[model samples]
Target: MKKPLIFVYFFLLISPVFAQMEFGFDDKDAFSPHSIRQVRRADVMYNNTVWVRMDLREKQNEPFFAANSEITKIIIDAVKAGVLRPYKNDSLITRMSIQEFNDNIKIPGADEGLTDEDLAMGFGDSDFGGGDDWGGGDWGSEGGAEEDAGPDEFFPNNIYILELKEHRMFDRKRSRMYYDIQSIKLIIPGELYPTGINKELATFSYKELVSNVFVDNPAAVWYNAKNTAENKNLADAFELRQFTGKIVKYSNPKDNVIDDIYKGNLKLGLAKSQEYEHRLLEYESDLWSN
Candidate 1:
């Protein structure tokens, strides 16, 4: 009697599956369209590549070590100590800091040997161009010309401001010419989360797994190139202003402006950079969309 009961239980268990197959409920044609394999957006999954353009003239110069360029010895030391990592490809590398980046960066008062006169603005070789960075002007004068600038204008005061897209703006209200970061291709790392059953079981696996598993796979650079024999990384590339950035790849390589193809393209600057990066990345992602 127990054997007969066991047989009945087995028959009941397999009957529905057999019935479903015979009735074509599990037919290949009945599969949802959503179940069909779809192509993946590699960038969405692996956000390891970046093309960045830093404007060294946009942000305020660090009062400590960076004046003309942010790539100073202190920053370089930090890179060497693994507080920072510069990348050229997938490899997080330590390249020799170019001598000019180390020696030529003009920190206001960091160097003991630099004389006040040496740092002072003298009318010496206006042989190239005459005047302060803004234009010919008295350095400490209270007023120059009080004119309201358009939304995109550099400065309201100072009758003459460099209007070139590449020029740095003078914030006359603050009496300061804040520095800008230059452009580069930086491969910033992605966020890490726990995997498998550990997601609920472990409290600290994500951070620990990332630190250990990706110790060799840290954020790095992508397409920053060094045509010169002098080895340089993303930091060095931006310090030297090595890259010319644009919203989209120029259809014509000879065209100096990226606006040729991307009509009405906004000029590049340090401000609104995150907005620009996001919108551009979206443009790239849209190509993969149905």
Candidate 2:
């Protein structure tokens, strides 16, 4: 009887351990879609999601926009080839079809009333000047009716802004903090549009990007200006954080961006963004305190 009671007590004491192990095994992939590391939910002591905006035209980010192998071009081509899945937003819940992706990236008035043959002819002076009526027949009229010349479609260079959504978390199991990127968004600058409102093309899962798009592609390169032989894969460049980005927002109760919180004061918002960066660094140090 004494032996049985001891065995029963020991089982109860170790039951929680077994339960924890099972939970970790089952839910290890919960964050896998967005994170390279398999972090268990129970091990996450703290978490904060942040949004960052990167300007590819910036000197520090020029490698991502290198000639002939721009990151934007690689991603856009992959989407068009049906090899990548685009999301409607950073939530990654809803998927945007290929048609939707195309429409989003297209310029407002591009390709309007233009046929394949018209496109093939090219928008050249010679092509529109051979007519005998009013130096190309009124220039803005077709078949005795006025016509509007639509705006041109977007080019890879026009997509200069990249938005990243990532979670900064402290994992108790690893006793370290991790920046787990979730999604990336492409943005056409507001200046490109008449209304001056920036347009979001589409969001993509970083998991798919790292696994499928950037991993083995030869064209996805991070150009090395100093050393021609030292060019790195885009995936490795991202892992090294070889780019500069400004924090636009962080996890907050109101879901407000830095600009919104500072009432659109650009200087104040920039300072606030810096403050948040410092706080994140200080947080890890604080955790080590006695």
Candidate 3:
């Protein structure tokens, strides 16, 4: 009886191990809370470390097919470098022809033999030469011109500004302090390329890059620090892009006026009212106009 009890106890302990190895134990199958399975991803890289990425599905098959092309990769690389001159296919052809235009006309510096109209077409302007409404007005400074200014100066610099549309706040309490994120348009400057390319042919807008809807409950951590610890300290601490909560207008937790709208300061109320009015006008004209 003692021998039988001993054998039964050994079997109970080892049976699960054998079953797991041979029959397989999947979380989906076993309905286990803590089971993990290998997930197949769209892209995989394992050079110094493993990296996996999932491809976003496009609404249309044409876009989906286009997304996976060499041209797309070339365009994406150009975009990442911030050197990509945005142009329509026809405009791009004309701009590239600039080199040819100069060469054909025997102009020493010409990239393409193109007319003034051709150059103007590429630059999205009706006329050629300077004073082409290069966006710099009496109020704003022109692009590419050397100007001594601080980092935050409005002068067109290497980085382009995307003017965000004023967002509306319907809820009276929320409106007083917080405003919703509205449309963001890319403010591409004229001086990006001195050679001048088609400005109307905007490469891609900021809104196009980032969707209108915010991602809900995205996986915060790429790699788990606890999992690294479990791996006998062989793994390094995971580097994560810490996302401070969504952009909120009134984030001050200590301020009582920020929360209480009725007793809120008059100045802030007046400012908010002005902002809300401006936003309402934009909504009516830019967003809701047929």
Candidate 4:
């Protein structure tokens, strides 16, 4: 009787080990209310992190694809309210009517090689230039930036500005009512760029590469700090539908950069919005679970 009782005791202690082995225990699979592992993320950003492009030039009928238009309107409102900034990329090309083009071309300078209007049509300037830093930090004294400004003056130089770099809406046929996000770039603040050794001009750091919707997408190289309801973060602001735009190609070409072979599939474009919503739900579910 004593030996049987001892054997039963050993069996009870050893059974769980075998069960754990069978199930294959891992940090992600195991959970405890008392302890939680914070997900590690990169501090600095780099180019090609998580960029998305939306094109809203397509015209859709009522209720079918109207979310595209509605989403864009919300984004435009955020921009106007100073909640989000639109990047005036010089690369953007706006379509002009034939009569409008002709009317504008009737300038004082007739021929003489090429007119300013013609050149303007070929290439235009966007407001995303590195003019006075977006955040209102006073300029350094007359001597020089280094001579007048202290390290404190330079460390937290300007408020980081968010901009949608590639915004384009061509006057094409209103076949599919939609807007397009030609490309999304996460431009870093100018003050953060590394100043040349000779002080000639500051250059963007490797971590400051342009590309990625740093606000909405958190898994990328940018989402590091935590945010509360009192103070909102980029991801929080974006979750409020602060970005509105059209989709050019539903299948982003940059998807090729990842091991996700199915992401850039052209076939998936037809059901993209649905697929995206599903993903969002899954992401939200993951927040509390695991």
Candidate 5:
């Protein structure tokens, strides 16, 4: 069971966003398809560790925009040149406090007894990367779907928020410059249980099974990516900010023996999730269509 969960978590952290985004360029200018802007993501091993940087032009950055020369590339290039580094490794990001976690992370039937202290403590000890994992414990089991929606839980799971300040475009020849700060939230899937009883059950044998059996629910606790533009007017002059993320392949998050969730190692895990998500969406659509 732990093996599968570990694999699934990897896929969730690395998979790219395939949905097409609309840049709202008159609804007819297909040239301005949604361009990915930020590419940073949280780490599964380190609580505050960021896996990637926001600039779109890095050895790690990939295509984020539908068009050829989107700002994502520009940002990436800047990162390579030391012009921009929106996210860093050593920096400490301010997140929600314990009270905020309860107010925001609680699921529909989540045990009220569970507190933020419990979560923080769990995170501190859960072998984030040093090979000292408390496998088969509550950290991987409790807090189901609700964990996926909230920022505190999800961001730590590999999703990240990359903000760009004072972004502007100028008609250099015309001597006019417009500036605004931009924020992008990117959802990077991490080690999470998808929606399926068999998948969850497979993680642990009957002997390893405990009171809280993980269900193979995709929404159980995953991350997502997004992009927001503060200055809408700049869309015409420059471009709407974007977010892009990627997943790498590694043996483990634990330094000793645990493997890190990376690409290519979790194909089947993702396929199962896709099938499950498809059925669920179909079922919901049918139910609502009536």
Candidate 6:
């Protein structure tokens, strides 16, 4: 009886180690209480991490892009309000300062060639360049000051794309699969840049967004077109998968996105993305088969 009691105590002490080994997760990777369907790592039979790109301009995703209450607007406002912290990337490990976030969203070269004193002296005025016949060379034209008069800032509406990093895992204990979202990233479309380079504004932890930012914030809403009264919280909308997104990347040893794998061939990349989707469905179906 004494030997059996000692063995039981020893097993209890080592159980956590076994759990870590089974899932390759440390305590830091434990599921958050706010997670939709909190499944223990040990219960995850299979896991696939995928990156999805959501185009808010899409008809199916318009609810999230509603005029004033755009999801991007809400997030940006929250960050500005100091209520939400942004991350450097989807890893969610490094925190981004508010200044850094602001810098990233600004239209590149928009503020170039203009100083505070220049604006105060009315050097930016259109009339200053036209009426003045001092040198007759158009000072603004020589200095390219006219280009600086373009839009100096980017609005939330300009951010029409969002990227999500998530893990789709089959929880054998629950006999179901779960979409465990990790992070949400705001993307500045390539068209917005002169060089056609898409810029990542910042990444927000999905757990933090769901549990704190969107959960109780009245401003963060999913606009309901049919009935204004039926508008739901952004958190609920995400859980319901109301937005449609394209799968861009899945777990790969080389960590290449579909476009890269397909060598920038849009059609092939799209087809491969669909294939991955079908594979997920087939995997779930096969789980119940003999």
Candidate 6 has a TM-score of 0.76
Residue 6 in candidate 4, Cα distance off native in Å = 62
* TM-score of each prediction: 0.22, 0.78, 0.20, 0.23, 0.19, 0.76
CA lDDT, candidate 3, residue 205:
25
Candidate 6, residues 1-290, lDDT tens digits: the string is 79999999999999877765655544455554335446676677888999999999998899999987888887766555455678999877889865577578767765567798877776433321222221122212121111221245568889999999988888886687788898999999999888898999999988887765677677678999999999999988988899898999998999999999999999999999999999998987888683
Writing each residue's lDDT as its tens digit, candidate 4 over 164-236 gives 3221121122211112223233222334445411111111111112121223322211121242223333334
Give lDDT tens digits, candidate 3, residues 1-290: 69999999999999867755754534444322111211112111110110111121212112211222212232232222233333222111222222221122121234245567866555222111233222121211211122222221222222232222222222221122223222222333445546553132122322222321111102111222335333211001011111111111232344332215535666665465456445545654543343
Better lDDT candidate (2, 3): 2
Q: Pick by lDDT: which candidate is best?
A: 2
Backbone clashes, each candidate: 15, 0, 15, 30, 36, 0
Error (Å) of candidate 4 at residue 17 is 46
Worst 10 residues of 3 by lDDT: 45-54
The model with the greatest TM-score is 2
RMSD of 4: 20.2
| lDDT digits (tens) for residues 152-268 of candidate 1 | 211211111111112122222223221222122221111111221101000111122123222332121212223334434333333354544433321234543333434445554
Q: Could you tell which candidate, 1 or 5, scores higher by TM-score?
A: 1
How do these models rank on lDDT, best leading? 2, 6, 4, 1, 3, 5
Positional deviation of residue 72's Cα in model 5 after best superposition, in angstroms: 3.9
Q: How displaced is residue 107 in candidate 5, in Å?
A: 46
Candidate 4 vs. true structure, TM-score: 0.23
Local lDDT at 283 for model 6: 88
Q: Tell me model 6's lDDT, rounded to 2 decimals.
A: 0.77
| Over 4 Å off, model 6 | 1-37, 113-151, 288-290
**Ten contiguous residues with the weakest lDDT in model 1:** 197-206
lDDT of 6 at 8: 96
